[model samples]
Target: MNGRSFSSSVRVGNWNEDVSLDEDLLKDFLEKREKGELLVQRSSNLNKNVLQKAELSISKDGFLHFGEMVMLLNPENSEQSLSNPSPVYGNYTLSVNPDESAIHVKSHLTAPCGVSASSNVKPCGRNAFIITSVDGSEPGEPLCYGQNFALRTTEEFMGHLYLTSDRKSFLKSSKKSHLQEVSLTDQDSFETCWQVVYMDPQLRLEHEGLPIPANTKVLIIHSKTNQCLAVLRKYILWTLFGKECEITAHTYLNGHRVEENENHWIIVTGNPSDDINTMFDRPKPLSEDINGS
Candidate 1:
């Protein structure tokens, strides 16, 4: 040891192996870490708080609303709306008919001063229902009913709706089956059901290969060709120029997208304690009781 270090020389060792032997560079690196500039900072874009707007929602009481507009029967019992007052026209309340699996859209609005009421009413106009024809294969019509119209669902969430005339048949299979009003009693009638598809948060009624496009004039087209479904477009027909307009649903499809909004639909009822099975399964109509099967 004395021979090797006779001159007594000392050397300093560098501890930072990554740095270029510069103190300034090491200082700059440490400063960047403290300021959160060098390492990946928490990205706000990935963790942004986005607010969503209120969209179409069905209540437990079977009341469907798009924002402030409620879907219901026209006071005049008409099928389509042409001019004013149509946007706000609709039944105030819509409930599910346990006896018939269809929805009953009722209106309490008064008719025009001289306009006659076609449906029976107690001062108020008659009630209408959202129903399809016997065989959904063809675009069905929304007709006026007394108690309620018969509508049946083939599945949960993304399912098909069938309109029955005498609680024995449903409108199913748009073009393929030639849109015939086949009786549910027939096994082939099972194919008559329409498909409820929710795409981009918008609800669409599709039958076999045909799609029901929604428009302000009509909830759906009579066919894929965009023929408007024929119905009595009811209005107040009041003497007042402003009051003579019709009331109809302005929104049919969703303006915004939802993850499961269109794909899912639940049976709504006033009785919160109602059993799901009983609500859906009545004594007259069996689960497979499509078209009165």
Candidate 2:
């Protein structure tokens, strides 16, 4: 995935320099707010030190863009952040794509997920720009999961990677599980953005009479490894060969989430065989440490 450009040190208010705080602690501050904690206090002190070092950017109509960063003036004291005294690190870029949607995101934090967090809308102020991730080779094999599209074409709204697989079955018949995925589109076929994956909750052994759900919520589990996969976003129900079924899929995470959430319409991509991500949970906002969103 692309690293955002909102990484530069920005003033929280009137501070002259950027104070160092724990990445994890800062993440927790965003995750759970705490009023007092030596570490949390130090973090707050540091944030207090960074306030508009450079002129804040604003749009002509007075709307914030994606690259623009916000400083936490008086970050709300939530169970997530108040647990510690470290400076608040959560930040977000208020951006709107004319064709897409108006989203306030750093996308997500550096980790798979930390915890659910909330911030006062007015207490936050503009600060810096979004820092972009390095453009180069990827870490693991490309797939339809992760922010990078693992191995698909349509980058932005058109996530063709997840659907563009000619083969219907990537996994072996010997294996059986509560859910499964099969490719339904081709790399060249230009279809709508939404995807469809057929699955059955209780599949019979030997791949016989496997019944995947048509509108059921399922994690887009990987094939070879069977590790926890991304959560399917859009869901719909349809018929197959005179039988009822469910189709689902989602934009997988790039191995990072604030914290796990249920029914959070998000998919995670990683090896199911190995250690990667947690199962599905209620959709919760990511940690608010580094960039308070």
Candidate 3:
């Protein structure tokens, strides 16, 4: 105590080294902390707002007039946010049947992707159904397209329509099988008709009835390759009587309007000079159905 300078200390109170920096240093540290908290709060708020506004985004429907996507509007600046392309919706399918009775539609929804389908029943005249279906392989909301789906409708008259969707891979294992069936006839008839309908692309008839029968309500199809080739109509039966015109000439003479002794069904008629020649004649009698399995 006599030789050395002594230092006197009472007691040291609690002091944190980190908080006990110089005044300027302390202020700078506090500012940095405050700024970090502010940034986190702002980011969180932006995410909440974006989620709330997602429905208005173009991805659900389409792009807005300003060319901004819905999901990207509120995302914090990032690479994905900058280079993102516009949004797109998913796809679906719809189809109908013949005889104006049933319809089918389909769509799907998965963990990462979803789809839906619906359809409308309709009167598919003359032609047979081939299990017309829709496919939605793209992203976003599901939509559909038809086999003969053109912007311009090509038919004498459009009939009843049905809409449906069977997505989610829940309905059937369609993804597993590529083979499908389109049949309007009894199973027993499939074998006999397959020769006439399936194997033959031209529907080769073995000197058979061209106009079909009244009981023949549907043309059996393979549910694929629905094309327009041979044509048929009920009124064409009269043309057959032309070969018998000489035989039925007496009947025609009596039954036809005696004004010119011609067969006039509707309000229209052309010259009766061999008008029957314009119609196709049966090279063979239309007596039996086709042959083969």
Sum up the clashes in candidate 3. 37
Provide the RMSD of all predictions against the true structure, rounded to 1 decimal. Answer: 25.4, 23.1, 30.3
Write candidate 1's Cα lDDT for 237-277 as tens digits.
Answer: 23211232222112233344232111122221122333321
lDDT of the candidates, in the order given: 0.25, 0.25, 0.20
Mark the regions of model 3 whose C-alpha exceeds 4 Å error after superposition.
Answer: 1-29, 33-43, 54-293
* lDDT at residue 100 of model 3 (Cα atoms): 9
RMSD of 3: 30.3
Name the TM-score of candidate 1: 0.20
In model 3, the Cα lDDT at residue 117 comes to 18
33-124: candidate 3 lDDT, tens digit per residue = 67644444544433332122111112223211112111100001133235643211111111111220111111111111111111111111
- C-alpha TM-scores of all predictions: 0.20, 0.18, 0.16
| Residues 173-228, model 2: lDDT tens digits | 10122233323222323221222122222432333223222112333333333333
Model 1 lDDT, residue 234, Cα: 35
Q: How far is 106's C-alpha from truth in model 2 (Å)? A: 25
